[model samples]
Target: MRRWLVLVSVAAALAGGCSQAQDASSIETTARDFFGAVSDEDGQRACALLSSDARESLETGGDSCDEEITKLRLEGGEAGRPEIWGEQARVRMGSDTVFLTRWASAWRITAAGCERRVGEPYDCEVEG
Candidate 1:
């Protein structure tokens, strides 16, 4: 019974890990499309890449993804596409590391720092 329990636990761990990896890859693709849109400086198109809450925030909460993109563009602009892990991602933007994520196929910029977080700015930077 103990051996069976152990096997079950292992299987669960493996399944969960695989799911996380798939989510990460999906996030990576979303991030690529998002930053690609940003590189083009299309706020509306880029905003389309953001989650609905993020979009609402941008439209109503007085948040500023455009400015963030512009600042990133000025600070030498983004270095490369983000590498996502689970619901989080990291990107090098000149001298800064930009945090990112995917919310329903939309890419949201959630943080800007060296180390990465796991869960608001951690959850998405493109906050309200």
Candidate 2:
């Protein structure tokens, strides 16, 4: 989860956009698109939305990223309010929380299917 936090922080920092509305909208769009790709079973598209580290983590054990990612069977839900701070961002949906990082000019998913755990880092299904 430390890895997940770091990634979120990076993106949140970059999220210092011209306006809060724009930043939030961009972040929300990325989150929705990521989950949408997952729900569609379009592993290639879903993997494209991931941060480099996340893609690396998902492609472990000699499996191709597209193949392995599809197997995760992540659930998609309606996006809710996003919590943004510095360089980290967490967007909560009805069923999942997604962590994203800003890499260059785009936002990428660092973790997904996350749930808060008391006295612990988020328990995430997909993380870097």
lDDT of each: 0.58, 0.84
- Candidate 1 global TM-score: 0.54
Query: What is the TM-score of each predicted model, taking all chains together?
Result: 0.54, 0.82
lDDT per residue for candidate 2 within 1-128, as digits (tens), equals 99999999888877755456676788899998887888888889999998988888887788977888888857868888787775578899777899988787788889988888999999988898
TM-score quality measure for candidate 2: 0.82
Tens-digit per-residue lDDT, 23-118, candidate 1: 655555555566667677777666665655555554534646564543344232435655766666767655555566666554565543333456
- Please give the range of 10 consecutive residues that has the lowest summed lDDT in model 2: 14-23
RMSD list, candidates in order? 6.0, 10.3
- Residue 2 of model 1: what lDDT? 100
Error of 1 at 118 (Å): 18
